[model samples]
Target chain A: MSYKAIQLIKRPSGDLTPDIFATVELPRPVLEEGQFLVRQTHMSLDPAMRTWLQEREDSYIEPVQVGEVMRSYGVGEVVESRNPDYPAGARVIGITGWAEYVLGNADMQVVDPAIDPEALLSVFYMTGLTAYVGLIRIGRPKAGETLVVSGAAGSVGSLVGQIAKAEGMRVVGIAGSDEKCRWLEEELGFDKAINYKSDNLGGQLDEACPNGIDLYYENTGGVIQPLVFERMNRFGRIVVCGMISEYNRDQPTPGPSWVDINLKALRVEGFVVVDHQDKAQEATEALAGYLQNGQLRFRTQVLEGLDSAIDGLSMLFRGDNTGKLLVRI
Target chain B: MSYKAIQLIKRPSGDLTPDIFATVELPRPVLEEGQFLVRQTHMSLDPAMRTWLQEREDSYIEPVQVGEVMRSYGVGEVVESRNPDYPAGARVIGITGWAEYVLGNADMQVVDPAIDPEALLSVFYMTGLTAYVGLIRIGRPKAGETLVVSGAAGSVGSLVGQIAKAEGMRVVGIAGSDEKCRWLEEELGFDKAINYKSDNLGGQLDEACPNGIDLYYENTGGVIQPLVFERMNRFGRIVVCGMISEYNRDQPTPGPSWVDINLKALRVEGFVVVDHQDKAQEATEALAGYLQNGQLRFRTQVLEGLDSAIDGLSMLFRGDNTGKLLVRI
Candidate 1:
């Protein structure tokens, strides 16, 4: 009859704080004709949530308004359905809020019930689609070209580096820690992984990418951005996927000068996965092929309950989560 | 016979000084088997010439050596020819140095002698091609969209605004002086023109582009860059054509943060006209059509003789030129 949900009480200033969100219990909604009820099983916590919390009018998607249940992508099952399209017991994936029970909308897709929810959320959903779209479609990485990805140990970055490697690119990753760097190089098959916290990041990048960076997958926008930007070869492509490092700051860091961008003939593009839903089937098929060949590997850092998502979101900013951050309801 | 030329005696540091160049008389070249002699009548002074003077290894083309003649684009008449492709009295357009006469290379294109040299350099040569490629091809602007062009009075920027207007787009121009702004709005058919040097540039831009900027043709990247960048609408495209404002500096100014780029799904692209030669014919035909329809208008600030070019080059940096800067010998 009732379900617990996290509601955004205050908009974040710099860093996310506990006071910004309030956990509350809400009555389950009665489904009308053509509407279905979904019991959310796993909700993804992403860096993009920071943008959704902002009060900006010009964001790609409408920001989650204050006093509203926080928005997220999740996998759920239809507990009760008035819509024949989503029969009871059918699994679905779509925009589900931080709640145990939600009234599913037309946007929700009925997915195979047999696929593991972790794999569904990690590889076959927004996480995998973002990486595929950013790297393959936007980046257009070529074989023998060098690809440098920031936040290489995180979900999208990890997938991007691995996908670049799968496409026969020389993949170099930049992560926050040496342990993550080792994981990227050894586990993800990256050609080289440099720790951004280490000394002489420019030098490390130079040494790693002797041929210069041809494609740069930008997830983190700290020291790695300018350094990799300077080393980009002529006609390089930079996929501005996420600037996770600058999400909490009031004034984000300035980007590299446009002079080099002009002189080097570089293309810097940004895209959100939701805008490219038409390519979802193609991306999923390609990612599934890679997954079947064992070229794709993913790890999940799951929190216990719905309430955990409030604090779990901050873990992404702090770079605490090892892989995909999710809240298992 | 001897002709006057300007040689880059030393590399410039910040502002270009007259002492950096040495005016000298050189003997006209005798035509070789495949070479032809060109009597350059009108040498174009472009902002891209500043980059040609820099000794960077990664520049789009090879930089002029310290002891070499300053590189430029010019329209000339072939006085003597050994090549069948270029006969004597044939008007040619291509890379020519700051000289009265030079040997023609294979890159030079023989133009119809009937076309005015000023018209060729201003709207049908590299200047026109650069504008056409950057705006139409890269920006992919649609009808009813807003286009804001920095350096709106300059050769390429002026053409870019006119072409956008011809394509049925709302055109806004950013220039340094009020006179140039007036010229843009009145003579060039720009919907609105803002003087970037005036107080409250951001407010002026907001007032000018009520619908927000969709395509930004960046020629000067100083105060106007961040202002236009901040006002870009969702899916906006920024064509980084030239950074004339930052070209003479020891350290170019940093660009706006790329956060908005990612959040709004923006595409920032930079290109050199030389790289897109395949589209030259298409651009020429399109530009010629605009010229025939009286849609494109141009102004030239012509300097007298090759010797004036040494001091005349500084006018571009000072924003002193009314339109396209050219040297008539």
Candidate 2:
């Protein structure tokens, strides 16, 4: 049997086009001993994927070698299993790829599908744990404190703002468009949402956070992140979850002078969810509680088929999507 | 009786010149209730002093206005005391100024000159506390780990190296000159010292820190700090005490991309010594024990008189001093 897969033929310089990858029919990967075959149904498109596709050195995960199937976190059904542990037709998620089927030996966790597919892939997979870890576990904004979240329209940023608001923090969000900003304030209960694309971002940010920022959830680093950094109160924490602004450029645009970090006494830290999977069970339970209580809300912008993954990713940079932008294959 | 004081006449654009300050002699203020008169003897010339003189809005301490006495950490002898809390002819240290005398009503701790003058001011005042808080209290390097320190020949950096050495960590120093590097390695028991002024800083840092940097005591920011930052291992901590390199610039120099901080999952934090003065007594007792045990050693570059304050501060950027650069009156 043969299956279609997106293979990385060449690395893009800045803007990624579909030509960088090619859809090819290949023999189905055979399951080895204690291995299973996953027929991937959906692939989570992320900003970090832009980093993975670039010609660069090693990151949190190994770089996808040329000629290899492109890397992605995928949700799929277990079609065949050589191991007694995973029976056939088991729904699971793991480090699959932009392929129709994945054959691997890594342990796959069964997805409950208690949440819908898009939410499961967006909230539970990459975005939820990211927000949970950075905002709750790391940033730890106290009650009545002013917390700022950048990329407010994005899946992770929205969740971060919602959770922080639920925890009694006065939450502010920075997004690219006024519409996105309104959604964040009205739908997600963000205290204020500043349009980063506007001319008076600095003025708006200052007005939004009069007492100065206590905790900054830095999702997109650019002019906006630096403006926020300057206003950070003493002992403020910067949970650097992503730098989506820099990911697509050949060279990242220079950020604001970090002299503020030194003079104001700030703590800037970065983390990834995959590295702290142990927090998965705890984060999931907490997030589930938020969902059940209606204190938490999420949105997903699903695109049709694996072919749309390339264009869906560009939405992140352009702020074209309102929430989790995913490719439903 | 009157004494001379250096007052900032104008805010500097970038580089500080002697023209910005004027030595004006004024009649001594009559001692008021609960006030003590301090005959300022020796003042600490620090990088942060540049920040205080800059045309900035605010920092850890309020910026020294253009016509005010230059803000500094000063040691002086109390010649007159009305409060009875401090006796006459008592030595004390406080946030005085670049002046011959300071009239204030704050609690003044009596100084015991058991240590030499410059060493006493350097090893026991703000410099000493800064090293202690950043290295021991914050960085918290465990045994057998490699600790890399930038500005390693300066007051705080040298102390950081010695303290880390005493803690049983392999210590590497980054200084501007070969002579300073030798002094750090030979006299202070640093495992290695990299000459940042040399062309091979990257190779030297790599050679010195073979296992990669576990903790980086960042006293100065610019070229040297970024080089050290590049070599830091995962989970490494950066103790940001000062950024002397950017202090004199109109627009602060941009450092390396923070993508490294994210990729390596590093913690880059900034702090001021004054904020943690409560740790002063505790740090003093511990540091005093190190000095007594000869596990800690220090050097001082002392200018002859108070007139030297203007030119004396230049020694920091030009790297003309070794341990503590002080103006001895």
- Model number with the top lDDT: 1
TM-score of each: 0.98, 0.93
- Give every collision pair in model 2: none
lDDT of 1 by residue, B1-329 (tens): 78888899999999999999999888877666988999899999988888888878577899899888899999899999899999999999999999989889889998888888999999987999999999999999899999999999999999999999999999999998999999998899999999888999989888999999999999999988888999899899999999999999998799988898898899999998889999989999999899999999999999999998988899999999999999999
Question: What global local distance difference test value does model 1 have?
Answer: 0.91
Worst 10-residue lDDT window, candidate 1 chain B: B23-32
Indicate which candidate wins on TM-score. Answer: 1
Q: Point out the worst 10-residue segment of candidate 2 chain B by lDDT.
A: B52-61
Point out where model 1 deviates above 4 Å: none
Instruction: Estimate every model's Cα lDDT from 0 to 1.
Output: 0.91, 0.83
True contacts kept of each: 0.87, 0.52
Residue pairs with colliding backbones in model 1 are none
lDDT of 1 by residue, A1-329 (tens): 78889899989999999899999999988778888899999999999999999877687789998899999999999999899999999999999999998889889999988899988988878888999999988999899999999998999999999999999999999888888888888888999999898998888888999999899999989988989999999999999999998889998889999999899999999888788888898999999999999998889999999889988999999889998888899
Pick by DockQ: which candidate is best? 1
DockQ of 2: 0.57
